[model samples]
Target: MIERWLPAAASAHACALDAVLFGIHWHMLLIFTAWLALLVVILIKFRQGANPEPRPTEARRLWPAIAIGCVVIGDAVILTTLALPAWSARIAPPPANVTPIEVRVTGEQFAWNIHYPGPDRVFGRIDNSLISASNPVGIDRDDAAARDDIGLLNILTLPVGRTIVIQLASRDVVHSFTLHEMRVKQDAMPGMTTRTWFTPTRTGDWEIACSQLCGLGHYRMRGELHVVTAAGWDQWMKDEQVRLTR
Candidate 1:
């Protein structure tokens, strides 16, 4: 299996990449052998003594046709076999049975504001006038939805095998949410919400980084994504809710 070839804590994206790279490597091997054989044949057969009388053969005419046909067929097969699965897993609509946990990720001038919906499953409304260091995201703490909000600078945790829907937006400049293991990367534009989803298959602590440059702190814009078992995640969520309530 493709996953077996990748790291034990590999995400869905990593698995897709592994599948694609495996196919590409196999293609490269075939191409290398074919080209090398062709070169050797040409060298021996086209030499001065080998073919003194250069005959115009129909081989050249069929070569181009054959190459084109092969290209088209190969592309179709590769796209269908390797690339489609990856794209579907990341971009396709979620299954009817899966209930995704929503996480609002807002990119600011220097830091990331990760707002979890607590136990309400709803994000709090934001008011521009209340925006300040103490209330970074302008979250209306009075709103019941925001009362239990656990805002973290960079740490992100998710339950393994559950689809997580991330609503991404930038508060100031452009930013990107990229997790190498998860293979989920999308740009967060100011005043706009970008959605990306991923189901973590492995349990581990992974890096959360901004792949796009927003400002001077771009290099330091780092976070951690903790993927844990369902029971572990439930315990964490319960603890978070209890702490927020206090």
Candidate 2:
């Protein structure tokens, strides 16, 4: 029943995230129900009709302590068993044999700048002074490695079944890169670089939203994520290369 409230999980990490969310929701529901029931009982017991005269009541010291202790234990159990392990696994390094498709993402005022290291798979150097209207990421055109570098505006493409490693940064203010389907959210901070990785298990198109309020145009700061099959990704890369060379 609760699954209907969430977006479809499209990445490998989505399952763990969904499980954590469900667990929290269920715990909250249990707590709410217990509190509601206690409130109803207290209201009935202390109603005007039930007790005409006001009397000094003795506090249930042991029960209050027990309730607090139970809450603390519940929180500790959830943190130790669910939250911490999931976070550790998420930040852990990938396996040696797994080759991830690396991409650089730079967030500006109202756009997402995606950089793909062309066929060589090596990111070119960037100069902040060289940033221009046309060159959003300030790619150094004179560098040999930058000859085939591809920069895109508000578009990111990934191949299914392969891990995607994104180096996230911001050019001006802070922005949050959020992908609902993939259950990935990270902050893109200026003067600081953050790394995030996800493996797309399904092929589909989704929106990358900026969760942070950076500027006036923050509402429109969105991008497209195209997850495709391996062959389709290769074809698209070739097509992009042709477009750039021409």
Runs off by more than 4 Å, candidate 2: 52-58, 128-134
Report clash pairs, candidate 2.
none
Query: What TM-score, to 2 decimals, does candidate 2 have?
Result: 0.92
**Residue-by-residue lDDT tens digits, candidate 2, 76-180:** 887888888889989987667899889999999999999999889999888878777777778897998987788888999999999999999998999999999
**What's the residue-level lDDT of 5 in candidate 1?**
57
Best by lDDT: 2
Error of 1 at 170 (Å): 1.4
Supply candidate 2's per-residue lDDT for 19: 78
Candidate 1 on 1-246: residue-level lDDT in tens? 545655453555566766777787777677678778878987887887967788778356677778667767877787899988867776776677989988988887667778888778888777868777666667788887788776777778899988888999998889998887887789989989999887788899878889898888899888888999999999998998787667
For candidate 2, the 10 contiguous residues with the lowest summed lDDT are 55-64
Error of 2 at 51 (Å): 3.2
